[model samples]
Target: VANKGLKDLKKQVEGAAQDAVTAVGAAAQQVVDQATEAGQKAMDQVAKSTQETIHKSANQASESFSGFGKKLGLLK
Candidate 1:
């Protein structure tokens, strides 16, 4: 009877430990998912800003060249 009690106690302890590990794993996964989502959003914003800068630079260069051509009497 004493040995049976010991065995049952050991099983209960193991089950509790497993439950704790599962809870910790789920919490860690949630943190990782949130970080990934935030990183993706930041990357998207950076990409958009980069594209806008490129477009503005291109427009400025085109306007400058056009003005130079007009001054040279090349485009009238």
Candidate 2:
């Protein structure tokens, strides 16, 4: 009778441990997904800012050269 009781206890402990492991695995996956999404958003913002900066610089350079040409009578 005591042996049977011990066996039942062991089974319960094993089942609980398995459940805990499954819960931890699921939580870890959620954390990984969140981090990946955040990283992608940051990358997108960086790309947009870089493109805007490049366009602004190009416009400035074009205006400067056009004004210089007009002053030298190379352009009307």
* Per-residue lDDT of candidate 1, residues 30-62 (tens digit): 999999999999999999999999999999999
Q: What TM-score does structure 2 among the candidates reach?
A: 0.86
Q: What lDDT tens digits, residue by residue, belong to model 2 across residues 1-76?
A: 9999999999999999999999999999999999999999999999999999999999999999999999999987
Off by over 4 Å in 2: none
Residue 75, model 1: lDDT of 77
